[model samples]
Target: MTVNDGTATGTTHGSMADAELVSTEVLLAKPKRVVREDLKMPDGRVIDWYFMDTPDSVMVVPLTNDGRLVFVRQYRHNLKKHCIELPAGAVSAGEDPAEAALRELEEETGYRLAEGEELVSLGRFYSLPSETNKYTNFYFARVTWDHEPILDNEIEAYFDMSVVTIPAADVFSRLAGEINGMETAGALMLSQRYIAAA
Candidate 1:
C-alpha cells in the first residue's frame, strides 16, 4: 500500500489495510500533550485513536567499572509504587539523544563517563507506536559515581529518586521478575545483543 501525506509518498507492504486520518483534536497540552485522532477505515468504519504527542526521549544503561548496573528507584504516581529502571528523560528540543542520555545519567544517578569512557548508542525504538509518536533512544556507557546527584525540581518533587546498583549479570533475572520497568527490560535485552557481539 502507498500513502501520500501531501509531501512524500511511501509504500508499505503489509497485510493490514491502512486507515485514513480524518481529524485530530488536542486533549491536553501541558507536561505532555494528549491527542485524539479520528480515522476512517478502509471498510467505511470510523474510529477514535488516543495517543500522546511528545518529543523523543532517551534511556541509559550505565555499567560501572566494577561491572555493576546502575538503576534508579523512583515513585511512580500512576502506579502508586516505586519502580526500578534505567536512567531516562525526555530529550529537550534541539538536544542530541546521546547528550540527553549522558545528562540523565548524571542527573539521576550522579554517574558520569570517566576518562576514555563513552556513551554507546544501542539504537532507538518506539515508546509505544500504537499509543504515541515518541521514540526513545537506548544507550550504554561505562561510568563512575564520583559526584552527588543533581535532581531536577520536577523529579525531586514528584519522585523519591534513589540510586541503586546491582550486578550486571543479574539484570535479566531481575527484569523477568517485578523489579524493573518494561522500557528498562527492553533496553537491557537489546544491550545483551551488543554485548554478545562485542
Candidate 2:
C-alpha cells in the first residue's frame, strides 16, 4: 500500500504506508483544521502526531509610495498577545495566491495598488513541516491608500486588527525585535532581497 501523508503531490512507497493511523481525533474544523493521528511507525513503534491541515495562505509585503511598509497589529488568541504582522490571509479553494494577496492587502490595510502597479512574487514556504501542511506564498506590492476599504468589522470578535506603518529602512531591526511572527519575518526577508535588486 502507498500513503502520501497528504503533504505533497506525488506517489509514496515502502515505509510511507507503514505509519498507518490507529486512532484519530478532530480538534478543529473550519477556517482552520487541526487533527491528531496515532500512527504505527515502521519499526513497530507507535506515536501520536497532531497536524493542522489548513489552506495555503498569502503574505503581502505591501509598500507605500513613501517607502513605508503596511502592517497589521492584531491580537492572537493562541499567543495571548498582539502581534505586528504583514497583511495576510488564506487562499480560498481554487483561488490564485496572487489574487489572495491583493484581496488580503485591501481587506486588512485598506491599501490597493495603483493602476498598472503589479505584485512581485517573492516565493512560498512551509509554515511548519513537522506539524502542518500549511504553506504560505509571499508577495510584494506597492499600494496607494487612496480609497476607503470596506472591511468586515467582526472578522474575528477578539481578533481586532489595526493598521500600522513602519519605514522600510527600519523594518529589519523591528522584525528582529518587535515583530515576532515568523511568517511576517520571512516575508520581510524575501521582500528585502527583491527590493534591493530593483
Candidate 3:
C-alpha cells in the first residue's frame, strides 16, 4: 500500500518524483556520511540547504492475544506534544523487517509474540524524496501474544497504552483525515481491504 498512489502524486500540488534534487558538494562531512546543504533547481538548478544523510526508520501495528492492539504513547519533543503510536522501531543494517518488528515489539512494548498472523508491507516512505534518496520501508503485522511484562527488555518509561479491543469496523472511522501516521493509516486501510475481501 502507498500514499498518493502516483496518479494523484504528480497531479497534486506537490511534485511526484518523491525525490528531491541535491546539487551541492563538500559543505560538511559526518561519521557515516556528508552534509550537502546546497540544492539545485530543476531547470537551472540552484543551491539550497539540505542534509546529505539520515538514518532509516521503521514503525509497527501489533495485535495481542485478547484481540486488542498494543500502542505506545510518548512525549514527542519535536511535536512539543504527545502522540498515540503503534509499537515501532528502526530497521538495523542488514536486518529483515519481519525480524526487526518481532524484536521491536518486545523491546518497545514487552510483548513477545507467539506467532505472526499476517504481514503487510506498506511500501517506502520516500520521505521528502524530492530532497533525498532515502526510502525507508514500513510494515504492519497482526500478531497474537500472551503479554507478561519483561522489565529488563522493555521501554524504560510507559506513557499511556491500551490493548484497544475495538472491532475492525471502528478502525477506519478515523482514516484519510485525522489519523496520525500515513503509513499506519495506509496499512490499516489495506487491512480493511483484505478483511473485506475475505
Candidate 4:
C-alpha cells in the first residue's frame, strides 16, 4: 500500500487501510511518467497520491565463463551522473520478462547465453514499492561476449552508454560505492547463490 500524508490540497495524517481509488490524474506522461491517484479512505477521506506509472522491467546478472560480470555504464539524465548497472530494460507489452532479460543483456552489454544455457530465475522485486507499480524480474545468465553492444541511437546520444566488465569476485566489494542503482544492486544480491555455485 502506498502511504502519503501530503495531498494535492493539503496534508493528511493517518494510516489508511482498504482505501479505494476514487480517481486518477495524469500529471506528466512519457519518459518520466507521473500520476496522481485520489484515494477514498475508509474514514471518508479522499487523499491525493502521486506516483510514477511505470511498466515492469527486467534485470540480468550476466556472468561470463571466465568469472567476469558484464555491466553497463550509462548516464542517467535524471541523476546527472554516470551509473554502473546491470543490463536491464522495461518489459514491452506482451513480452515475457525472461525474454526481455536476454534481449536487454545482448543489447546493452553484447552478452548472450552460452550454447545450451538458459536464464536462471532470480525472482521479481519492486523497483520502488512506495512510488510505482513497477516491478522488475531478475535473471542470472551465463553468457559470452558474442558481438559489439547494440544500443539505440537515441539512448546512446542521450545517455552515452557503454559496456564494461569486472571480475565476479570483486563485484560484491564495490556494491554501494561503485555500483549504486537499486535494481542493479538487487540483481547482483539475488544472483549471489548462483554465482557462488558457478
Candidate number achieving the greatest TM-score relative to the actual structure: 4
Alpha-carbon TM-score of each model against the true structure: 0.84, 0.82, 0.61, 0.88
Sort every candidate by TM-score, greatest first.
4, 1, 2, 3
TM-score of decoy 1: 0.84
- With a 3 Å backbone cut-off (N, CA, C), the pairs that clash in candidate 2 are none
- Model 1: pairs clashing at backbone N, Cα or C within 3 Å: none
**What is the per-residue lDDT of model 4 for residues 21-53, given as tens digits with 9 covering 90 to 100?**
889899999776999989988777898999999
- Range of the 10 consecutive residues with the lowest summed lDDT in candidate 2: 7-16
Q: Which stretches of candidate 1 lie over 4 Å from their true place?
A: 1-17, 193-198
Model 3 lDDT tens row, 1-198: 236654432333333133356555655564335556544443444556555465566666665445455566556656776655666666677888767777777666666644636566766565666555555565556665556434332433544343333444455675544357665665565445544432
The per-model lDDT (C-alpha) reads 0.83, 0.83, 0.56, 0.86
Model 3, residue pairs in steric clash: 19-129, 19-130, 20-129, 20-130, 20-131, 39-48, 40-46, 41-45, 41-46
Q: How accurate is candidate 1 locally (lDDT)?
A: 0.83
Q: Give one digit per residue, the lDDT tens place, for model 2 in 135-165.
A: 8999999888965544676564457788899
| Backbone clash numbers for all candidates listed | 0, 0, 9, 0
Q: Give the better candidate number (1 or 3) by TM-score.
A: 1
Clashing pairs in 4: none
